[model samples]
Target: MAEITASAVKELRERSGAGMMDCKKALTETGGDLEAASDWLRSKGLAAAAKKSSRTAAEGLVGVAVAGTKGVAIEVNSQTDFVAKNEIFQGFVREVTGIALEKGDDIDALKASPMAQGGTVEEVLTANIATIGENQVLRRAKAVSVSQGAVIPYVHNAAAPGLGKIGVLVALESDAGVDVLEPLGKQIAMHVAAAFPLALDENGLDQDTLERERAIATEKAAESGKPADIIAKMVEGTVRKFAKENSLLNQLFVMDGKTPVSEVVAKAAKDAGATIKLTDYVRFQLGEGIEKEESDFAAEVAATAGLTK
Candidate 1:
């Protein structure tokens, strides 16, 4: 038995595209031979995962789990929508979402975390890929917690209890009880799902996004054929309106369509006789940013059949 170093395992992993643990095992089994280890992984069908990795995995579930005041939302993506309905895939998402609640939002940390099932999350994910014959990715995870009030979760278009197309977690920090916070948090979470606010507040909005908006505003204001100072004021107003519409706290409540989210929460707190602050939130819409590849099935099948015209 040869000593299998970390470098050896890493080289084998890169060559075979298998999980770290699987690579290490392959190296140990092949007496630290990288080529043989790659062969071993290929024989096990684990290396096939690499071939499928290029496929866009933008169709899966956004899973949410809440434990007490803490809540987590995770997006686990699959190559096809049919696989999203698979129990194995859904079970993996549920288990991983639970692990994410404990592991926090760092994707690397979540992947490396040990699962109650027999292996680390990444290892299990690799095995799942081989078993399911589809590319699956643990895209992102976000966790939000409140020190006192409640972190409420809501799933829109739910495929299961906590699994869905959209998962939202709203953290309400307050001295109020769950009874007061739960309803308010839920409504806000639903609003987040529907409105897709870019940030919690104006300050939280992305600088680049603001700059882009400003540039667009500046261009459009200039097109008005007005004076320089007037154009500047116009640009300012346009940017301000953009920020207000996109920021969660400033955005009008979806429920009422008139009251801002900040006001809605404040009114809820007032009605409940408590100081409730909407602190943080996470909205994981499944495959929100991934660019999915489109292919014609007839053309693909014809190509596969070697019947090119």
Candidate 2:
């Protein structure tokens, strides 16, 4: 059996959200294999879908860029939040975002694309990690574009130009000039930041999400002592309400708090005397789903000193 180290157990605990002893046992049982240990925890129902298996659990910036009718959002992660404020780190994020605009959002392509400073993006990132004295990763990049309209980018409480905790891009396809579309796009982006819509429209929402909602509604409706037919109607109505609330187009505008987003777009088109369609959007909130490890310093000291068993 391979010896399990403290750092290995700590990592496993963070990844699986399991107890310390459970993590140590899993690592020991798996001979210090992270993946197999995660599998072991999952088999024992300690985690949900190997939460930390391929996810980046770090702090950094979600940088966004918009040019013409295209926009891109990229997540660059660092081991500590301090690196987010570093000049070199911010510069890398800005350059990578611009490169993403030109080279497109395919991460591999963006990494291989030229950098104004020196070598490829991947090379610069590697150099930064060494110089910055911390681990970092270019986690994800995505782009949205329209044929003949404007792509607007918004950074909530922006730390700098296009970098912030939450970055949003709204793609509007319209015959209206940018002068008119830009404000609309910005407002839509703001709404997205607040509403946190799951999809741009009902069709865009995945079946799995709808199914989960349906299951929850079914359980709730069963407690009402309602008949079979009425219970069915209750579940259907509940799901429809969920779809309307969670889908961007059907969701009420956050500004007015009443008008559906689709209606808002229609009204904008009527006022501008040009067709306006909210085609797509992207919202990246930094470290949104990744769980961070919160340490108990006192407990750690005691454990280190073998004062607690």
Candidate 3:
């Protein structure tokens, strides 16, 4: 048998558009022959994922898990909604989410981490793609933690126990017991799902987003055609209002539509006899950014049939 170097496997993977692990296995099976490995991948349909990779994967589940004071959320995307109903796919997501609780918010680290069942997460993901016959991607993940209080997890309209279209995790740092923290954290997580605040606070909001808001405020202020300093004040006032409305802590509570989230936390703490600080949170809506392919079914079927006939 020929020795298969890392570069050899990489070359094969690049040529065949198969997964890294699949390319290595193919090379090993074919005695380190690149052409033969590519052929093997094609024959096994493992290369199909690459062919489908260009298509949008906008349908899938968001999985969330909480272990003690730490919580993590993951978004696993597939090209079709059918994949979301697959038991194998759901199981894979659940395992990955469990791994994520330990892996934190770093996507690369989470993908490289070892799975409980077997192999690295990347290896398992490749295997799942080959078996499940869909181009599935572990898109993104986030983690929120509290030093003393609860990191509560919530799934909105869950398809499975901890898997759903929306997942939210809220971290409450407090001297409060689990009994006091759990319900409070859950209410906050629920609010996160509904409100979809851009960030926990103003500072947490991205610079680009802030700039965009400022630009809008300036444009609107310019339309008023007021004095220069007056326009500047208008912009500032608009931006301050924008910040408060978009920030999680400053947003009015969805449950009551009057009290701000920060005040609600304070009230919860006062009622519970503890100091509860809303520390951090993460919210994932499945396929939040991906663009899906849209086409006419009849046209697609007719095109697939025969143009020569």
Per-prediction CA RMSD (Å): 2.3, 10.1, 2.3
The 0-to-1 C-alpha lDDT of every candidate, in the order given, reads 0.91, 0.87, 0.88
Q: Which residue runs of candidate 1 sit more than 4 Å off their true CA positions?
A: 2-15, 19-21, 32-36, 302-309
What are the TM-scores, per candidate, against the unseen true structure? 0.92, 0.78, 0.92
Which residue pairs does candidate 1 place in steric collision?
none
Which of the two candidates, 1 or 2, achieves a greater TM-score against the reference? 1
Tens digit of per-residue lDDT, candidate 3, span 1-309: 899899998898778787777888999999988888888988887787666666678888999999988889999998888999999899989999998888687899988999878888877777777788878888999888877878899999899999999999998899989888888878889999999999999888888987898999999899997999999999998888988998999999998999999999999889988899998998899888677778888887888786424
- Candidate 3 stretches greater than 4 Å from native: 3-11, 296-309
Q: Candidate 1, residues 173-261: lDDT per residue as tens digits? A: 99998888888888899999999999999999999999999999999888889999999999999999999999999999999899999
Per-residue lDDT of 240 in model 3 = 87
lDDT of 2 by residue, 46-148 (tens): 4542332233347889999988889999999876788899999999999999999877889888878889988788767756765676667788998999999
Tell me the number of clashing residue pairs for each predicted model: 0, 0, 0
Name the better of 2 and 3 by TM-score: 3
